[model samples]
Target: MVDPSQAGMVAVGAGLAVGLAGIGAGLGEQAIGAAAVGAMAEDEKFFGKGLLMTVIPESIVIFGLVVSLILLFVF
Candidate 1:
């Protein structure tokens, strides 16, 4: 059986991993989204590139999820 303290620590770790990564991703996306919007406003042709750039920060959340899963199931 898992010790209560260990389980709590693991839970905290998982939460932190996801929470911090999400915050980081949000910050990154904010800047990229602003730039993307500006570029799109300047040129409609920039829409695709803008969208791609904005979505790039989403990978950070994905990585965080993976780490959380690992902490929950593998530790």
Candidate 2:
């Protein structure tokens, strides 16, 4: 029911929100994975902590996905 201009703007906003979030998540995970690998390589005892830290990025991704979905449905 939206006019073409408004609809386009909304779609653009949705795409930006989701796309930027995804990029952030990807960067976060890459950093964590690298750190985990580095830590594990240096010391085996770091396994637990490294794993926890690495997986922490998953929450960022989940949050982004949730926000994207909410935006899609709510708007």
Candidate 3:
């Protein structure tokens, strides 16, 4: 069997990976969703800004992916 500490670390790492990834997705969706709502409430012209803002969360996911990769390699 695997070492308990090692297994615990793995679990922690996985939790971090998933949690961070979800956070990233949530962050990404938050702005975009907000913008969408604003646009819907305001003018159609806001569509472009909303779209741009929505995609802005992609960076967080990218960072999370990098962290995950690093963890995978190290672990």
Candidate 4:
């Protein structure tokens, strides 16, 4: 049986894992998205590369979610 106190701490840790990861991803996406927009403005051909770069930061959020789920379920 899980102790109530320990369960609460685990919940907090899981929340923090996902929250901090999301924040980091958002920051990264902000910078990448700006650069992508600028590059796209300069040349239409840059759209593909810019889009790819902008999307890469989204993986960070996915990773964070996986970690959070592991923490929540695996202790």
Error of 3 at 41 (Å): 3.9
* Candidate 3, 1-75: lDDT as tens digits: 446668778667866986778787897697679769878688878777777777777767777767876765666
lDDT of 2 by residue, 20-72 (tens): 87788789889888989998999999999988987776777677667766666
TM-score for each model? 0.93, 0.70, 0.63, 0.92
CA-only RMSD, every prediction = 1.3, 2.3, 3.6, 1.2
Model 4 C-alpha lDDT per residue in residues 1-68, reported as the tens digit of each score: 45777998889888998899899989999999999999989999999999999889889889988998
- Output the better candidate (2/3) by lDDT: 2
In model 1, the runs with Cα more than 4 Å from the true position are none
The TM-score of candidate 1 is 0.93
Over 6-71, each residue of candidate 1 has an lDDT whose tens digit, in order, gives 998999999999999999999999999999999999999999999999998999999999999999
Q: Report lDDT per candidate.
A: 0.93, 0.78, 0.74, 0.89
- Top-scoring candidate (lDDT): 1
Off by over 4 Å in 3: 1-11, 24-28
* Highest-scoring model, TM-score: 1
Ranking by lDDT: 1, 4, 2, 3
Q: Give candidate 4 misplaced runs (Cα > 4 Å).
A: none
Please list all clashing residue pairs in model 2, or write none if there are none. none
Rank ordering of all candidates by TM-score, starting from the highest: 1, 4, 2, 3
In terms of lDDT, model 1 sits at 0.93
The clash count of every prediction, one per candidate, is 0, 0, 0, 0
Point out where model 2 deviates above 4 Å.
Answer: 1-5
